[model samples]
Target: MRVHKLTFAALAVAASLPLAACQSSGGGKGQSDPSSAAASTAPSPSDSKASDAKSPAGQGTAAATGSPANGKVDKCRTDELEITAKDNTIDGDPDGTVAVQLKNRGSRDCTMSGYAGVDLKTNSGPVSAKRSGEQAGPAVLKPGKSVAFGINYPVNNSGGSGVRITGLLVTPPDETKSVTLDWPGAATLPVTESPGTPVKVGPIGSAGQGG
Candidate 1:
C-alpha cells in the first residue's frame, strides 16, 4: 500500500514540472517586439499611391511655382508678355536663331518695349548682347493686341557651347513697373559658323527683376 502511494506521488510531481515549464514559456511570448509589431501593421507600397491620387492638383502647381527661388510671378498691371523659345538653347544644338515673341494681353492699350538682352554665361563669366525693339501698334491695346520681336544670336561670338536663355526686360513708358519675361534660362552658347550674322546687341545682365 505504501509503495503504490509513493509511485502515484512521483508521477504527479513529473506532470507539475511540465505545467511549470509551459507557464514560463508563455510568459516569454507575453508580448511581441514593438519594432516587429509596427512593421506588420505598416502601410504597403500601393497605399502610398492611393494617398497621392487623393491629393489636389493646385497643391502640385503651387509647389512648382515656389520651387525656383521661392518663385513668384509678379503681375505687372494690365498686359502680360509670354516669351517662348524655339529650342531649349541647351544640351541639343540649335538649328537657327531662337525667336522670342512678346504679346500684349490686357484691357488697356499697352506698350511692350525694352532692351532684350541675352547673357550666355560660362564658368569664367557672362558674354552678353543687347538688342532693343518696340511695338508699332496703338498705344492702348483694345482687349487683345500683339507685338513680335525676333533676336538672332550671333554664332561667331556666342563664345561657349552649352547655353541657356535668360529673359527679356520689358519696360513700359512710365516705367512704374518693369516686367521681366523670365525665360527657361542661362547656358553655354554653342560654337558654330555664322553665315550672314546680323549685328545683335542688348543690355548687360541686370540684377533687378524688371527692365
Candidate 2:
C-alpha cells in the first residue's frame, strides 16, 4: 500500500510541472512584450503640453493684427481754415470767374480734396452752382498753406436786368461749416443769364491751378 501511494503522488507532481511551464510561456508570448507596452502608452505629458501651448500664442497673434491705427490722416475742418475771395476774370473770355481761396490756420497738416460748395445769394433765393472741370487729387495742406478754387459765372450785359449779387456762402472741400463772404464778382455786371448759361464751380488746387 505505501508503494502505490508514492507512485500516485509522483504522477500528480509531474503533471502539474508541465501545466505551470505552459502558462509561463503563454504570458511571455502574448502580453508581456516590452515593445508592445511602449508603443501603446508612448504619449508623454510633454507631448500634450507642446501641442497645447501653440493655440493661445496663435490666437494672440491673430488678435494683434485686427487693430486699426495705421497712421492715416484726417480731412481738414472748416474752423481750421481761413477763407478769402477775389475776382479773377479774364477779359477775352465770355465768362468771368471769382477765385475762392482757403488758408490753413491750424498747427498741423490736414487734407483738402474735391470741390467746394458755392451758393450765390440773390433776392429770390440761393442758387446752388454745379461742379465743372477736372477733379484735383488730394492736396495736403500744411500749416499756413493755402488752396484756391474758382466760381465761373455769367456776366450781366443788358443793363442790369438779371440776378443782382448780394453775398456768397462758401463751404470748403469735405467740410461741414460754411463762411459768408462778399460777392467777389464785378459790381457793374452782376451775374446775368443768357439763353443757356449755368454757374460752374472748379476743383481745389494750388493758386490759379484751381480752374
Candidate 3:
C-alpha cells in the first residue's frame, strides 16, 4: 500500500511542473511593451497641418495671396474707379508720354500692384498692349485718391499714316472687370502699319510719370 501511494504522488508532481511552465510563458503576454504603446499613440509629423494665419511677417493669407498682411485694403475693383485719358499737355507729360488717370471713387481705401491691363480699341478690333517697366511696388489708394500708368506706343515717327485709336479699355490690377473711356485727343498714338505688335504699357504709377 505504501509503495502504490508513493508512485501516484510522483506522477502528480510531474504533471504540476508542466502547468507552471505554461503559466509563466503566458503571464506577461496580456501586457503591452511600454515603447510600442507610446509609438502607437503619438502624433506623426505627416499628420500635422498648418492653420490659416492672418499675415505680415511672411505668415498669413496676405503673404500667400500677394497682398499686404495688413488686411486693411483690397485690390482696387473696376466699379469703384473712374478712369480718364489725358493729353500729354494736360497732365504735363514728359515730352512724349501718354498717360491715363485712375481715381478711387469708392468710399473705402483700395490697393493695387503690378500692371493695369490696357487695350486700344480701334476700327481694326483691339490692340493689346505689352507690359513693361521694373516690377511695381504696391500702391494704396485712399478714398477720392488717384493713380495712373503710361502707354508706350510704337509711334510712326516717320510721320506716315498710322492706325487710329477709337477708345480705351482699362482694367485694374487683379480684376476681371474693365472700364471704357474716350480716347483723349491729346493722348494720341500713331502706330506704324507694321505687322508685329509695337505697343507697350507700364506699371501702375503716378499720373504722367511714363508709368
Candidate 4:
C-alpha cells in the first residue's frame, strides 16, 4: 500500500510542473514591451517639428497670394477719348488762342500728363507747332470728365502775312492717331496766305476754361 501511494504522489507532482510552465509564459504576454508601448503612445520628435513648421509656412503662403492695394492703372486709348476745340481770342492782341478740350468718353478712368501735340492744317499741308516751356498738372479723367490745353498762334495780319489755318490737328499724349478740329469761324482764326510756325501748344489742365 505504501509503494502504490508513492507512485500516485509522483504523478501529481509532474502534472503541477506543466501547469507552472504554462502560467509563466502567459504572464509575459499580459504586460506590453516598454519601447513598443512608448512608440505607439507618443509622436516622434521629427514628426512634431515637421507639423509645427508646416503651419506657419502655410499661413505665409496664403498671405502672399492676396492682391496689392496700390496697383498700377492702365493707360488711355485713342478710341476712348473725345476731342473738342473753341476759339479763345483776345480783342486787341493779334496772337490767337484756341482752347482744346479732351473728354473721356469711355467707361474707365485714365491718366494724361505733359503737353499735347498740335499742328495747323490747310488744303496744302500741315504746319507743326512748338511745345511751350510751361508744365501743367497731371489729369486723371474719369468717365465723362474733361481736360483742356491751349494753342497760341499769330493772326493773318500779324507777322504771318499770308498764313491761313483751316483746321487744327490734335494728338493726345502717348497716342498715334490724331483728331481734326475745324476752325470755329473766320474771325476766330483769321485766314492768312503766308504760313510760318503757325502754333505753340501748352500743357494739359483739369479746368477746361483756362490754359
Question: 2 or 3: which has the higher lDDT?
Answer: 2
Against the unseen true structure, what C-alpha lDDT does each candidate score? 0.47, 0.81, 0.74, 0.77
lDDT of 3 at 164: 72
* Every model's TM-score: 0.33, 0.61, 0.57, 0.60
- Local distance difference test, candidate 3: 0.74
Return whichever of 1 and 4 wins on TM-score: 4
lDDT string for model 1 (79-180, tens) is: 355444333233344423444444455544444334444443344444444454433322233335444344445343355454443454444333355455
Model 3, runs deviating above 4 Å: 1-70, 89-96, 157-159, 185-195, 206-211
Report the C-alpha lDDT of model 3 over 25-133, residue by residue, as the tens digit: 8987977989999999987765543222222435554457885566677788888988888755334433354688888899999888889889888777798988876
Candidate 3 colliding pairs, count = 1
Write model 2 residue lDDT over 1-211, tens digit each, in one string: 9999999999999999999999999888777678888988898888879878998889989998986577676788999988999989888878788989888889988897889899888775787888886858988888888889888887777675577778889998777799999997955335444543367888888345321
Superposition error at 31 for model 3 (Å):
62
Error of 2 at 117 (Å): 0.6
For 100-185, candidate 4 gives per-residue lDDT tens digits of 88888999888888877888776557778888878776778888888888888766653433545578888898888888888752
Ten-residue region with minimum lDDT total, candidate 4: 184-193
On TM-score, the leading prediction is 2
